[model samples]
Target: MDLAEMIKILDRQLTTEGRTIHVDKAKEHMRIEQRTSGQGVSLSLSELLRRYHEDGEEALNQTILAIDRGLHAMASAPHLKGKESKIFPVIRSASFPDHTSDGRRLITSAHTAETKIFYALDLGDACRLIDDQFLDQEGLDEQSLIELASFNLSALPIKIKKDVVKNNTFYFIHTNDGFDASRILNRKLVSDMQAKAHGDLTVAIPHQDVLIFGDVVNPEGYDILAQMTMKFYTSGTIRITMLPFIIEKGKLEPIFIMANKRPMPGKSKR
Candidate 1:
């Protein structure tokens, strides 16, 4: 199927089934980074290029496809069981003290009690740490890092608030860099939320892709397209970067919305 149909299916699964592969990807990625100590076991940029160069695009693409499928399956798995094979009292009893059978039960109970903490530290912290490392390379600086860390610290509580939104609720993430835009724009699943784009700035899943709400801008001096908008849906911490040249030259800079009102019923999602 084409990307549009694939995205439509994903969207339907999210809205109607109360399930989404996207969330699964997030969870699977979380687990992988945790397992790898925050450095993903997946291929790096250099490795990906080398694979492509030596094996050809088909081989490289297949590798990526397999990874994507793994992520999807990991995300889609409905059940996960965590183990507690180490507790101090149990370990001590088994190795040295030879404590009573009741002591084993107590140790097991305690280990079970700490599941939330263990999961939080292992799953949440690992994911955020690894994601932050990547985002920093993508464009985040020190201040943005701090802000995102704060957001991750509160992610659990915040995710609850996020869950209350209606099924059709949309999200748009805009960044000042065109590279980031290019990286994500091809994913129709995300781009559907976009309402506009200018230059390096691109919108996701606009209700109308052809009837663009904003014009594209090719800004000079920087190798990028630049624009801004306000209609973006924001549920978590958002990092905004105004292009440096725009700031230095005291230019007004193009502004655009991140999100827009849903198209009228029967209107096509272009």
Candidate 2:
């Protein structure tokens, strides 16, 4: 099915459940609002359409079910004080909203030029980004929140799958647990990868569900990584960045890759 047909079907499905859907064709997304509470979310159709093309309508239906659960969870999320363990850092595109629709600032920190770190409370099937008002209600300071979130992130299990292309090794973390990219915040993991790298250590979080580590020894490796990252970034439901980073001494510096030239580090914005 095409995007228009998909949007029409989704609109009918959600409206029957009391949502007000506004199609923004220019942006290729639908802004869905809860008619009773005014809480809303922007759902991008690009990735959904891509999924429909690859996995057929059954996969699309499953994704829509997940979206519905996520929306319901957002509308009725719980308090934060006793749920400290569920709080974790999430990696989002730098272009993500910094404030709620009602103007409450979101809790976030600087990461790199292409991405930012935001804190969220995991709600099993979904998560809600922690805002300034939520922090105030919990009486938690930003530093303490970050510390707790980081601790929670580190406590999660690490899983990696290895692949090789033209003698260069690539390690991928794709747990499909919605925090795969957030694992980048786990310092020990990156440090361990760096220690084992035969050459320059490169990292890419092209989306929320994938984290890629490259052991680059030749120029061709950078080219392959660039193509691979672009593919994932374009098809991702929640894209982070197409640009990869060089991890040096615990600092992440974004790099620019040309087809046949050396990758150059871009100036750090954070």
Candidate 3:
């Protein structure tokens, strides 16, 4: 189906459930207003459209249902003052919004030039990004928040699957626990992977649901990783970056991968 048809169906379904939706055809997104709270969320249709094209109607239906559940959870999320343990860091694309629809700045930290770290409160079915207003209301400082989030992130479980492509080994983490990409921030995990690397430990978070680690032993490895990352990035529901990073001395350095040339770590633009 086309984007227009998808949007029409989404609008109808949401409206049928009593949502106040304002469609913006030019921008290809819709604003969903809460009935009682006046707060609203801007729903981007580009990713949904892409999913429809790639995965068909069942995938589209699942995504819409997840959105509905997420919205309901967000609308009724508990106060953050006592939910410190439930807060965790999330890695999002650098292009992700820096502020909420209501203009409250989101709590974020710099990661790489292609990605940013944002904190969110994990409400079972969904997560709500922490904003400036929520921080103030909770009387929590950024450092404390980061500490709590990092601690919680470290505590989460991870299951890795190893794959081989052209004699290079790639480690993948995709638990679908909603924090798969966030696992990149797990220092202990990255350190462990570093010990297992046959060459430079390469990392790629092509989307929110997948984290890739490559053992780059040859120039062809870089080319293979680039192709794999681009494929996942394009087909991902929530894209992070097509560019991959190499862990050097406990730091993430973004790299430029060429087809035949060896991948080189690029200088940070930040």
Q: Identify the leading candidate in terms of TM-score.
A: 2
lDDT of 1 by residue, 14-65 (tens): 3322222332333222112222122222333334344445556564445444
lDDT of 3 by residue, 182-261 (tens): 99999999889988777878899998889999887777788888989998887666679999998887788888886455
lDDT of 2 by residue, 203-250 (tens): 999999999999888887888889989988876767899999988888
Q: Tell me the lDDT of candidate 3.
A: 0.83
- The TM-score that candidate 2 achieves is 0.90
Quick one: ranking by TM-score, best first?
2, 3, 1
Cα misplacement distance, residue 231 of candidate 2 (Å): 1.7
For all candidates in order, the CA lDDT equals 0.25, 0.86, 0.83
- lDDT at position 91, candidate 1: 9
Measured against the true structure, the TM-scores of the candidates, in listed sequence, are 0.17, 0.90, 0.90
Off by over 4 Å in 1: 1-41, 78-270
Cα shift from native, residue 244, model 2 (Å): 0.8
By summed lDDT, the worst window of 10 consecutive residues in model 3 runs over 261-270
Model 2 weakest 10-residue run by lDDT: 261-270
> 1 or 3: which has the higher lDDT?
3
| Residue pairs that clash (backbone atoms under 3 angstroms), model 3 | none
